[model samples]
Structures are given as structure tokens and as C-alpha cells.
Target chain A: MKELYNLGLSEIDIKNIIETYPEIKDLTDEEIAKNIEILKNINCNDKHIRNILIANPYYLNRSINDIKSLIMKLKEINIVNINLLFDSNPFLLNRDSYEIDEYIKKELEEGKKLEIIVDELESNPYIIDEK
Target chain B: MIVDELKRYMLEYGFNNEDINKILAVYTFKENEILFFNIKKINTLLETLGYTQNDIVKMAKRFPLLYSYSMKNIKQKIKDMQKLGYSYNDVIKIIKQLPAIYGYSIEENIKQKIKDMLELGYSYNDIIKMTKQLPSIYSYSIENIKQKIELYRLMNISHILVEKATYLMQSCELSFARYMFYKNKGIIIDENNYPKLFIDQLKFKRLYGIDNKTLIQMYNYDEYFSKEKNVLIKI
Candidate 1:
């Protein structure tokens, strides 16, 4: 928790995260610190970074390479608020490039504006699930 | 001082020395009212569920959210599933597979979905099996799930296969274009290979005989994939 505290999460952020996902306690300081750095490098806003971790406490469990690819995938699609995208679906980072590309292409084919698809990605990953 | 205080606190709640040690082992000792409150809430919930001391410690370490959820909400989520035909033990197992199930809004997400599935001739046993196999299906709205089902029907995908392969199929990340593109090229979206839709763009194009330039053109043209109807093979 102190490691998270040092990485720009406030006392409140740490407390809220722990209360939400106590398994975060087992995350090593180094592992969490690395993910924090990865997210910071991609988005660079403390609040956004905190939100990503809070929404997807499992972010620390993914490889940094996987996280980077997810960020790159969104950047490829020109999404402005990458943090918001991650916040809605932390699993986005775990999705392969094919999944991300197909999502964008599928929405475009249905006459959905690209921006709307991006908006949905950031708003609720649930909508993208196959019904 | 805080550790000492927490030990006394848990002891008062009928938690034994072993239980206190287990809880302390899973968390860093921080002196805060909310933290202790959460610890108490989590312990009480687990005890009522008949979790052994060892099981509580393990669950706490592996899935801390188990401890943080309001016991009331957890019970409600379980009871709701029981009403949907899963036994109490089955509900417990489902939550273990998808802890986030407890976080879902039942009325908005779960209830209508079960009702809709039943209307479509899916039995409670079938739905429960699907839910257990693909716990994330609970995340989708009833309409969203129906739309996907409708797409399969529209494409003339085998009805038997759709029902038999639903758990794996429901979770694929494929979209309408990807689905039709493969169908146009004589590729069936099977439970095994439907994931091709989620493959790397270049590899998918190469594997399925589509081209990047055409896809890019389709992507840029924007309004529709093309002006002509059924131009899916144009790729």
C-alpha cells in the first residue's frame, strides 16, 4: 500500500482500492510499481492512472508488454481518453490485437460512427460482449 | 498499536486467535475505522457461509473482494440465482468463478436475461450451465445477447451448433463485419476458430484471403462498407 502511496495514489485511493479488492494486498510493491509506471507513460495523469488501477486492480497481474499493446491499440484508433477506455474494461489490456481491430471494424460496418464505438469502449465493456 | 487494537476487535467478534492471525496475514496493518469495519464484515460473511478458518484465509488472499462486499448484497446475488434455478451450492460456485457477479445490478442485468432465454426455449439448466461456463455473459444486457443470437440465425448458422456451442460462442469478440466477411469467404464461425476474428489484422487478412488496402478503404469510406448491397466479397 505504501508502494502504491508512493506511486501517486493518495491515501484515499489506496484505502478504496484495498477495500474493493483486498487481494491487492498480495501484489508485490515492485509489480504494482511497474504497472503504475506503464500506465503513467501511456496516459500521464495521476487521477486517470488511479482510476485504471482502481477499476481493474488486476492490471498489476498483466504483463507490462500486454498493457503497452492495449494502449497502443487504443492509440491506433485515436481514442483521446485512454484511461477512460481502460477504466471501462480493464480486460481490454488482455485482449489480443485481433479482438480490438475486429471491434473497431465491426462497429464501422454497422454504420456506427468510429467515435461512438470508442465511446462505448470507454463507457461499458459489457456492451461489446457477445449476447 | 493498531495491530493490537485489531486483535482485540476481532476477538470481540468471536474470531479466534487463529482467525485473527489469518486476517492479519492477508493485509497490512493500518489503523482505520473503515478498515476494521471491512474486516469484521468480511469475516462475519464467510463464517455464516460455513467457510473453514483455512478457507477464509485462502479466499481472503486470492480474492479480497470477497471480504469487501456487503454480506447483504452477496446474499441477494446468491438468492437471486437460486430463484433462477441454481441451487445454493451452485450459486456459490458461480460466484467463485465470477466474483464480479455480485457487483452486477440484478434487475437491470440478470433477471430479464433469464426470462428472455426461457422465452427462447432455453431451459434453466441450460442457462445455468452457460452462466457457469461463461460467467462474463452476465455482463451483457438481454437485448445485446438477443442481437448476437439473431445475427447467428440470420446468417443461417446451424441452430443446433449455436445452442451446443453457446458458452464459448457468447464470449467471442467478433463483430458483424468479421462474421459476414468470413461467411462470404466460405468460413464458418465455429467454436474452435471463430477467434480468428480477434487475430492480428495482417494475419487475419492473410489467413482469410482479405486485403489490408481494401479493409482500410472500407474503414475510411465510413458511412457504409460500400454503396452496393452484399459487397462483403469485395474485400
Candidate 2:
């Protein structure tokens, strides 16, 4: 761990990082060195690694593959999180991609000038049955 | 420097005095680089033309290079014209002369309206409620009660229905009326499930033996239909 401190991190930074990431707190010197090497291999800089460790200590001892998996999960749940963000900033939400499609389909009939793509989804019996 | 060019462009474009002044008000001038002017006056003329201040500001900011010539002096000139009383159409002509103003987009206008409505004593929920009725109203001017009335007329909503819907929308917890109003004409309702098709309330009253006052009260109270538990005892 001391050899890995090539960037000369401050005592506060080390303490903060260790406090933030519980996994790093219990790691032996050899384990910390291994984790640092793994982090560097994954294109993560020391600052980023430190920030992530501080934010979620449990991820400190996790493999790079596990971290990548966590990010994938975040993207998978993007829609639900995006909706929550939209709830706070409705004006910023892009109407074209959001509920506008469903709104147009449910509210308007076929051949309407503004009929959204959702209308196509709803009108197609195959899709409905498949769903 | 750009002011001169804007003047030349305006002359080339065959803009009138009112229109030229409007452009001058919205355009700004840097003192050291060139003589500058306030563009706020142009805002009033744009207002008369039905263009919001935000829209004009956006246009000026977006097309600084294209409109740089007159942009500097346009703002002050617009303010002067407003003092004398110019129309918004005249102002919009100048705004049109400028390219795109990002700040004056429709989304910004809606936000401004929501802010104004809140300042005018509308509650957060009421503002949201009104938004449901007239979604476009968020972008358009809410000060124009006439437009609201016209929207109601266009929706074929009767005065009695308006009274009922208004009462229901305002007093009852139902937000469907607002949704319906925005969906159809901007008329709020007590319930979303209620038939929104154009059915004259007067005719309904005559046919159903329901009085206007009672209907209005019922709609407001969310008691349009008398279920056993929902019966309103006139105390």
C-alpha cells in the first residue's frame, strides 16, 4: 500500500478514502497493492479509484469484473432512475422519447397527424398478444 | 460597428421605423468597441407582437455574429419604442431578423409562465392542475383570460359546465379535469372518467332534472353521482 502511494496522497486523502471504503480498511498491504494494480488495469486513475472506494467501501476488495457488472446494473435500471430525475425536472425531459409515445397512442386515434410510435405498438395485435 | 450593419441590413430588408427600433432595443452595444444600446424596449414591442421577452433575448444571443451589426443598439431602441407604445408584431419583425436565441425557447417561456403564475398567488398544486388543463398555456400568456375563455368555447364547454368543472377542479382533489382540459380544450374537471364529449350542461340539466347550482356544487364536491355513502345532505 505504501509503495502504491507513488502520487503522494495527503494523510487526509488516505484517511478519507479508507473511511469511505470499508473494504480497503481491512485489506492487507499486499491486497491493497493488488487492488491498486487491478484498478490501474481497468483504466481507472488513482483519484477515481479513491473516490469510488470512499463512496462505496464494499467495492474496494471486489474484482474489476464485479465493478463492471455493477455499472451494467445501473444502466439496466436507467429508465426508472431517469423517470425519478424527470420528476424533479420535467421541463428538461425530452418529450420525443419519454411518455409522449404512449400518450399519443393512448389519447389519439390512428391516422392522427401527431400519432406517436406507441400507437403503432398498441395497434399491432401481435405485439399486444406477445406482451 | 455591427449596429451600422444591422441598420444597413434593416434598410436592405425594408424594415419600418417601428421594426427597426424594436431590433435596436433587443441588441446590446459595447461602449469601448462601439456605441451600445439596451434591448429591453424591444421586448415590449415583441410583447405586443406576442413574442415573449425571453424569446427575443434568445434570438439576440443565438445569432450574435449574423445580427452583431445592430444587436448592440437594438435593446435600448426597443425600450424607447415601448415608451412610445409599439406593437409586438413590429418587435417580432426585428427578432425574426436575428437568427436563433437559445434562451427564448418555448421551454424557457413555459418556465417563466409557471413562475409568474406562482407569483400571482397560484398554489404549486394549482399551477400543476392548471398545467394539466392548458398545457399550452404554460407556453402562452396566462394573462390573456380571453384566450382561456375562447379555448373553453372551442372545446364546446358550456358556461354551466365551466362553472361545474371549475368548481370541481378547484375544490375537489381530482386532477382529471386539468388533464382533460389540456387534452381537449383547457377546461379542468373533477373526474377524468366523466364523459368529455361536448354535452351541453343546460341540455343535461333539462333532461336530467338537475339544477345548475346543484350540478355546479355537486361537481365541485365530487358528488356528481349520488352513491349511498356519497349522498350530500344539504345542511
Candidate 3:
């Protein structure tokens, strides 16, 4: 909690996060810090990191390896604006990499260009959601 | 000591630690300046102008830079809004709604924005009407405003809808993509039925009889659908 405070989140912001995803309270503080570090390594600034956490605290529960491979898959599909992607839709990183790939594959099979798929996902990322 | 005092005052005024941090981060004052003095002065001015301390707190929270503007600048901005024909109460409403209006210059931004909107065929009343509803209109660049209005016009959306639902000004690209989806789906979007253009989530599923995945496909493959239609026409 202090780590997020030092990162400029208010108590209210942190409280809102915990209220939305109570499971987050069970994650060790170090685990949360590590997830934040992973985001910073990808060039996400404090605001982006804050937005991602607020949008989906589940990133704290996901393993570092899970996050890295999801990022790798996104990069493989020429997703260069990684910071914006996760900032806009933090849940994107929570889904299984295979699920993300299958959605992209389905879109591509429908004759939609890869760039268009990537573009739409960035703008309206819920397009890739299972629901 | 001054920073601590200011923080304490903000806390008493209902600002959270985050709000205080935002003000401290964005407001750059000279080292020798009496920061707390300036804040108290702004608070007094707002109170003198009929705002309760609670109203001032809400305004500052919505636009934290309210602490940074000089008292004179705040007065002039209010007066300028009045000069534009808003009554004193209307000016108060504008400030309460968009304290960020203090940040915009009269000639460079607000007046020019109105002029541009006027040139684009909106009457003075229309501009006033929309701005009263969405005070952020003064902050948006004329080009941004023009693009949103043009997009709505292309979709056969009524000008009155933009006046009533000012939030429709935001998200031009998403709106365009949705417009394409509506066009392909044969969903008519006019002033009366335009809400269909924006219900992008579950309500959309219930309303359109299509599931989320189909809606996503339609929005994502709008270009493909257009091409397929073109090819069919040629065939």
C-alpha cells in the first residue's frame, strides 16, 4: 500500500481498487511491487501504471512469466504501443496468451487485415473479450 | 513549513492525499512566495462571490489548478464570461462546472472557439446552449469540435442531439467505427434513434438481438464488409 502511495496513488484510489477486487488484499505487497516493476520495464509511466492497476488489480495475482509471455504475444503481432494497450485495457494482459492469439487469428481468418485488428483492439479492446 | 500548512488546509477542506499531491505537483510557485496566503485569498474571493467553502472545495477537486490562478486572473475570467452575456449566476455555474476555464485565454481560446463555431453554422444561442451543458467545449480546439460535428452530420445525426448530449463530442474514432457498424447493420441513427449508436455493451446485445462477439466482428470488419458490398454490387 505504501508502495502504491509512493507511486502517487491516493488512499481513495487504493481503497477503490481493493473494493473492486478483494482478492488483491491477499497478494503480498512484494508481489504487487513486482507487477508494478514489470509495467515500468515496458516504459509505462506512473500515470499509465496507476491506470492499469486501477482498471484491473488482477495483474498483481498473475505470475511474472504469465505477464511476460502475454506481452511477447502482443509484440509478436506488431503491437508497438504496448503502454497504451495495457493502460487502455489492463484486462488484456490477464487473459491467457492462447485466448488472445485465437481471437486475433479468428479476426485475421475473417479477411480483416492484421493492422485493423490491432487498431480496433487498441481502441475498443473489449472486442477481444470472451463475453 | 508552508507546504505542510497548505497540505493541512487542503486536508481540512476535504482534499484527499492524492488531491493534495496533484496540487503540489502541478502548482509551481516561487520559493519566497507565501503559498498558503494565496490559497486563502482565492478561497475568500470565491466566498465573496457567493460560493460556499464546500463549493470551492468541489471546484478545486475537479480542477486542481484552481489553486494556481492569481486572484486577479480569476476575477477577470469571471468578468469575461459575463461580458459574453452570461448572467452573474450563469458565470458562477460555468466556473462551478469547469474551473479549468480559468486556464483558457479570452482572445486566444474562448472567443476564437466561439467564432469558429459560429463560422461553422452554429448560431450564438447554439454555442451558448452547448457550452452551458458541457463547459469543456471552450477547451476543445475548433478542429476537434469541427471533426465531431462533421462526423455526426455525416451519420445523419441531428445538430440538436449534439447540443443535448454534449458527451457525444468525445471519442471521434470510436464514434466513427460505431457509425460504420450501424450503417452495415442497417441501424438508422438520427436525432430520435441515435442512442443505438452508443450502447456498445450488453444493452447492445439485448437491443440488437446480436451477441457481443458478433458486434465486435461487425465493428472490426467494417472495412471488409464495405468491400464485400462493393464486390457484390459489381457482380
Which is the leading candidate under lDDT?
Answer: 3
Q: Which stretches of model 3 miss by more than 4 angstroms? A: A1-131, B208-235
Model 1 regions more than 4 Å off: A1-131, B1-31, B47-68, B119-121, B158-175, B186-206, B209-235
- Per model, kept true contacts as a fraction are 0.00, 0.00, 0.00
DockQ of 3: 0.03
Higher-lDDT candidate of 2 and 3? 3
RMSD of 3: 15.5
Model 3: per-residue Cα lDDT over A1-131, one tens digit each: 76778777767557656654556777777988998998998877676677666545546766688688888888888765577467545556555566577778888899988877876665455456422
Cα lDDT over the full model 3: 0.66
Ranking by TM-score: 3, 1, 2
Against the true structure, what is every candidate's RMSD? 14.0, 25.9, 15.5
Tens-digit per-residue lDDT, B1-235, candidate 3: 7788888887987666765664565445435146678778998999999888777876665455577678898899889998997888988987776566776667655787798888877888788878887665664444446656766766667476545645443344445555666767776567787766666444554676764444444454224323322211100
Model 1: residue B193 alpha-carbon error in angstroms:
8.7
Share of real contacts kept by model 3?
0.00
Residue pairs in clash, model 3: none
Q: Which digits, one per residue and each the tens of the lDDT, describe model 2 over residues A1-131?
A: 47336634556445544432323555676766665565465444444344333222333354445334433432342322222121111221111222233434544555444322322221221121111
Highest-DockQ candidate: 1
Candidate 1 positional error at B134, Å? 1.1
Between prediction 2 and prediction 3, the one with superior DockQ is 3
Interface RMSD of 2: 21.5
Each candidate's DockQ? 0.05, 0.01, 0.03
